[model samples]
Target: MTKSAIRIALCVALVAAAAIVPAQAASGGAVAARSRSVILKHIAFHPRTAHIRVGGTVTWRWRDGSIVHNVVGSGFRSPTKAMGTYTLRFRARGTYNYVCTIHPGMTGKVIVG
Candidate 1:
């Protein structure tokens, strides 16, 4: 075969490989995992309760009209902060509880499966 013909064949093979590659396979490992957010308003977590899968993350945002609130974990003293946000990743299959230190009556829970 001619040298130019060999080069052209190689180029065509590369083009075919590129065209057959799945887009997802190229960046699948670097893609960011999906996450969810919950709002804290009216001195309480808007949903008050929720369920999520392991490896998922939940972010708590202070709503504009919300009263001061916090997300306190067990054995952890002093709630995080009011008008502030906190994120927790559910890495295990279990239930976790949190409450507002500013207001003892406000509470929330997360069930991970």
Candidate 2:
């Protein structure tokens, strides 16, 4: 095959590989998650409580457009954003509570064990 054909094949192969791979959190954290995502929509956390093992990660994806939100927990906090992502890696075993300061009664927790 021509060099051009080989280059095209390589590009296609790369794209396919990327598609099959699980995406890491924005933090670029090394730990993978047992439970991958939490959706923020309609002013609430979809699961409300997330469970993961120690060294696992939890990613909060903001889907509520134009309405800003943030995750403020014991030792970590995310920037107040309307359209972005927040990732937390649980290093210890226990329950970590979080809330969106802008919205009262909007709360959740991460249970790591």
Count of clashes, each model: 0, 0
Best by lDDT: 2
- The worst-scoring run of ten residues by lDDT in candidate 1 lies at 26-35
Q: After superposition, how far is residue 34 of candidate 2 from its true place, in Å?
A: 1.6
TM, every model: 0.60, 0.69
Please write out the lDDT profile of model 2 over residues 65-112, one tens digit for every residue.
899999998778899999988887888889999999999999999898
Q: Model 1, range 5-112, lDDT digits (tens) per residue?
A: 999999999998887676656665423444677788777786777677777787889884646666787643334555667777777778888888777788888777
Cand. 1 Cα-lDDT: 0.73
Summing lDDT over every window of 10 consecutive residues in candidate 2, give the lowest-scoring window: 24-33
Error of 2 at 57 (Å): 0.1
